[model samples]
Target: MNDKRASHGFRLTLAMLACVGAATLAGCNGGGDAHAQGRKGGEATAWGLPYFNMPDIVPPNVRQDAYTPLTDAQAGPPIDPIKGYRTEDLGGGVYMVGDGIYNTMFVVSDAGVILVDAPPSMGEKTLNAIQQVAPGSKIVALIYSHAHIDHIGFAAGVVKAFPGIPIYAHEETRKALAQANDPNRPVPTNTFNTLDVDFPVVVGNQKLVLRYPGPNHDPGNIGIYHPGQKVLMLVDVVYPGWMMWRRLGLATNIPGYFGLVKSMNARWDFDKLIAGHFQPGTKADVETQLEFMTDMHNALTEAISTIPYSDGRLNAADTKNSWAATRDWTDRLTNHCVNKVTPKWSTRLASFDVWIYEQCMALEQSIRIDGPSLR
Candidate 1:
């Protein structure tokens, strides 16, 4: 039964494809009200792909063209860190770090500095970004929110910097890392096991809480919470206050993803969110994520409710075409999101979100039902 593949692939953006971006798009310092839509004012289309018309509330400097597959950068199009990694000091030497897509929250505690996911791509400049905050504190702990490469790719950098620092991850996560690290495997550079920590062993730290969000983004995915700062570091499972100029909705398997969101929400919560990517967010993002999940849930419920497609229409879920609920969720995008950026971006968000979701769906179908434990 594990061979369930959706009828078609939905579009996605490079920004919305991972645990960090869509997962953490909810909470921002600005008014935290979940908008019914974004502020994109215009609409455009290209490549026979219908461009989504949006409201007039786009973010700054977003490219409006649909991001077709780029063969150049493996990480999609590269974002400028210097201009974007605008670190905000929350006093006490603690910093909520990121440029919008990949933000890390660093806690300079009495013991040492704890980093929630290193910069996805780190060189001397990335390391320098952290050092500027605390000149000589060892990266005492490296906590990964999920096994996705964007969240853990910089582990090598952190390892090079801290050497034997206590790297933490879900037990399952460590196993995924080993597989990803083997050169023989495809996508060997996946930052699957960058930080190795046992969730049961350190679930409740006096300073921070570590959690295992099973089978949500990945089976080994875990979340790190800093109770003191009210910073919840989890991604992919939930996204908050996301700008849709990217039209990022990479839901691979609707039925399965619905189950995942419910399971993770059963895990943890926080006041301030350090998502895998995008702005530091709030509880509202979790709720928005729930909405998406609920919608998908209902979609599946309707699709499965009716067995024969020729039978009278059952619901969004009843027909074998029930998977359309996944794209239906995206089509309901707030127009303001796509139009919020520069002109000619009607396809940008839809192109990215739709495609990424397709890839995830395709991958989900390829895996075995009783799949190997990432651990």
Candidate 2:
């Protein structure tokens, strides 16, 4: 019995060391702690030993079948270096203007031009994009999809240039902007609370609908639908060809986010989807993400059920007194979920292996603590 206990202790120590090394090597500089549960609050360690010196986390071996191929859209024409942005018409006067990484929309109307979400990355390039598509047409309005500075911060610049153009956002967004007090992201001149679900802004033949599809990304994130163009614009919710941004795009409400994805897919009649991140997508792409998320949900459910809350090999006193047990359980559960889903999703979604652990951790927390509740 003594020899058996010693052997178990040694193996447990090695496993802990491996995890510490992986976390250290992986660089814990990610957005937030696992589940935003306020960090482990000590020297972040693996098995009570300092983990900073450990080697990086080893990714699971990529199966030949799990490789994600770049679609034609992703490999589409490079942004013109000279122009600094590319403007592609999506028919009916709606245009997708990308300054390489981020894309926004602009609709040409008889009265003037309407711009949606002027990302700071686009900078002066946004003005140049508008010039290429609708020359001499003044921007009469600016639509903010959400209060995220990355997406709507440049609206301040646009407002300065086009003065008096109405800035539109959901009531939740207006409140968020006021609290954030960011100079770059000015509060909206027009705000809509729960009373207004569908707010339409008509610019000649161009009709843009601003909607609060319940809080998914942030409190006031709104969706922009251009019915005339058969295009629906929402940001940070779905990635067309890639795995979702880390932590399900850092969603505040996980179930709400999932619900939004399902509701949006069924509710809209548009052919083209402007997810406001990666490549704009088709109905098929939206369905692809939905399928991937469903698979993740199922995988997490299984991991939660089969994985023991505490590994028997762990030191009982250490497990009870320290972060060891929680850490051990999370490591085991995360790997289990990763093994189950990565085989199929890695091949279908870009960067699946890169961010899958964080994705699983976030979902596991939501399932356990959030109690399957939707607010």
Candidate 3:
């Protein structure tokens, strides 16, 4: 037999011996339940072997019995069931509308209304909110944050409501929408390039400075800033009090995501942040999220450096298969990273347990493949 086959056979024999020995011990001890014993003993596995305290919420394999409860801060204000959506006036004529889950914004001016994003979840309620707040004003322009379907799915409805209304977005967004060929999100009528300088979209009496800070959550996801209102609307990048959606809000570029968050926190002169989810955020929320992200980065960096590839967890036969070996190594690294962060962050961020594993897995891969640059 070949060396690999021999090694596999030897390891299988050892595993069988270990199992027999374990059974012998149980039988000698009046056939005690190993799983029950494991629970009574500190840091024990199901078979009564000592192990780390694994998190209750593991993903892709382990289904959580119940997710961590949301704190009052994370829940934000309740939406009115009758109206199906709630609108918040953020000073000036800018108002935010959401169905307690998805959010979008609009700026009303003497000339007309400049609406930003049209989440399908909000649907026609977006128009209702605009009518309730702006009253009699026409929607002259619709600005898309990016080409994501969830954020701009209701653009079709907006177009139907106001025909021939000019739609504006970054040049990249237009390209993506055109490629998507999604009728729900008609290609922007007007597109601005965000190469070196910030693009300003002036409609009616309102003006929004659209700056594409490279790719973060998605390519061409621009920051919609209202200088007059001191409100900055950047969607899918920051999650305020809650944990970010899976894979860092499914960011296309991990390094860019990090850099954008740091840049926005440092450069943007805004009091309120409309992060396109839940309620608007403040500088404190941004700082808190930054701190959490930094912790995750540091923990993952240490884990990658300390954890060995040959951790003895993989079967001997699997070593010949590179894909299997890599999967085992990454799983071990991710679990270590998850355990390190859970202690401090579990209660700090809402739904932290829900997506922490995915976040760790994403960062680990980025660190290995994309180079470690959490600017």
Candidate 4:
């Protein structure tokens, strides 16, 4: 394995030099000029390598929003200080509340209401959204999408607003929260320990299907389904329009993350997906993500197999500097994947250029070290 990996790294280094010769030049003053030229045409030439043969596939309905310079809609309605969060009705008593990023779901029923994942960013705004839409409705249940502090960090707020409300989460989430002691995210009131279980939250006329689709984003993150509304709320797993967060949502299990996407694509019969971030996503959005991930994976695998050495800094006899050499090799491998994958993906996905390399680096580490292990 070591010999093969070294050969793979050598090939990758050669490819990097061929693709971005000026940037890879050991000490060239004209590196900046070379980089600029590379941007103009080097990007195209670099992507022509055999590893990146995946067709430039993207969904017809993919979002083309700019990464910076927030448009009026992206900036969110004139920031009313008094009205905390913006609420978008997803119909059938389901709604999404957030300030562009960090979103959660809520459903109103005759009995009361069900709220999912209250991040500290939303804070009291989540309650405001609930009240704005369902006036006089009591929050009866709080669902923890996972044990992540960023997603459910405002548990104290929820408990304060609706005392004694039953909280639902997978058993692993309960355990993780119990161990962490984060004041923002409290332990759940109820927990389930199964990989896949159908636990229904029935209040009055509303019913939500709480499912554990085997730990993808976190140990116990779940997919909340509103059968009547035909909407699925899977937190931190999929970004609606923009690129998936750094490290593919910082997944604990990379393969598990991919599996979760496939599982939802094959099984869910919903129209809209409340993918836990950005704007509301659709089936097409989900499909686009799958395509992006698969393309990156294929490109990374090919580069790893074809490279001649791990890092360009070390030769066959550099046994004394092995650790330093390994570190440098990782960066070279990461950059090669980045240069190769960005061109095709940048045109199709929003902010693809911004986060593509970060995602590539994360995947490179996982693939090289973890070797396709789900965990």
Question: Which number leads on lDDT?
Answer: 3
Which rank order by lDDT, best down to worst? 3, 2, 4, 1
TM-score, per-candidate, Cα-based: 0.55, 0.81, 0.86, 0.79
| Tens-digit per-residue lDDT, 143-191, candidate 3 | 9999999999999999999999989899999999999999899999888
For 204-304, candidate 4 gives per-residue lDDT tens digits of 88899888888688888888899887899898887866688888889998878888886687667788888776778888888888878877777778777
Runs in model 4 lying further than 4 Å from the true structure = 1-84, 310-319, 373-375
Q: Give the Å shift of residue 282 in candidate 3.
A: 1.0
Question: Worst 10-residue stretch by lDDT in candidate 3?
Answer: 43-52
Model 1, range 80-171, lDDT digits (tens) per residue? 64554557676555577665556677777556677766655443444566677877766677676655676667776777767666666665
Whole-model alpha-carbon lDDT for candidate 2: 0.74
lDDT scores for all predictions? 0.46, 0.74, 0.81, 0.73
Q: Which stretches of candidate 2 lie over 4 Å from their true place?
A: 1-76, 315-317, 373-375
RMSD of 1: 14.0
Better by lDDT, candidate 4 or 3: 3
Going through the candidates in the order shown, the clash numbers are 57, 2, 0, 14
- Against the true structure, what is every candidate's RMSD? 14.0, 9.3, 8.0, 9.3
Task: Summing lDDT over every window of 10 consecutive residues in candidate 4, give the lowest-scoring window.
Answer: 51-60
Sort every candidate by TM-score, greatest first.
Answer: 3, 2, 4, 1
Residue-level lDDT for 283 in candidate 3: 86
TM-score of 2: 0.81
